[model samples]
Target: MLYWALVFFVVALIAGVMGFGGIASASAGVAQILFFLFLILFVVAVVMRLARGGAR
Candidate 1:
């Protein structure tokens, strides 16, 4: 999931550099959504682990 976000971010950068406004914007949006989703999932997993008394 994070890898995909990074891929889209890189794609956005390249598209922006090439003056592809539409493609850049779309890719950036996708990257942002993916990044946030990944963050939320990570937090949820951590919380779940702690609730389970992690490492004990």
Candidate 2:
């Protein structure tokens, strides 16, 4: 999911460079959303692991 976020970010950059305003905006939005989702998922996983006594 994080990788997908990076991919979208790069795609947004490229679209912006190529002057596709709408595509760039949409891709950037997707990247931002994915990035946040990835962070939330990672935090949740860590919390669950700690709850299970798996964290040192």
Give per-candidate clash totals. Answer: 0, 0
In candidate 2, stretches whose alpha carbon ends up further than 4 angstroms from where it belongs are: none
lDDT (10s digit) by residue, model 1, range 1-56: 99999999999999999999999999999999999999999999999999999957
All predictions: root-mean-square deviation over Cα? 0.9, 0.6
What is the Cα-based lDDT of residue 36 in candidate 1? Answer: 100
State each model's CA lDDT, in order.
0.98, 0.98
Per-prediction TM-score: 0.96, 0.95
Candidate 1: list runs displaced more than 4 Å: none
Instruction: Give candidate 2's whole-model lDDT.
Output: 0.98
Candidate 2 per-residue lDDT, tens place, 1-56, comes to 99999999999999999999999999999999999999999999999999999977
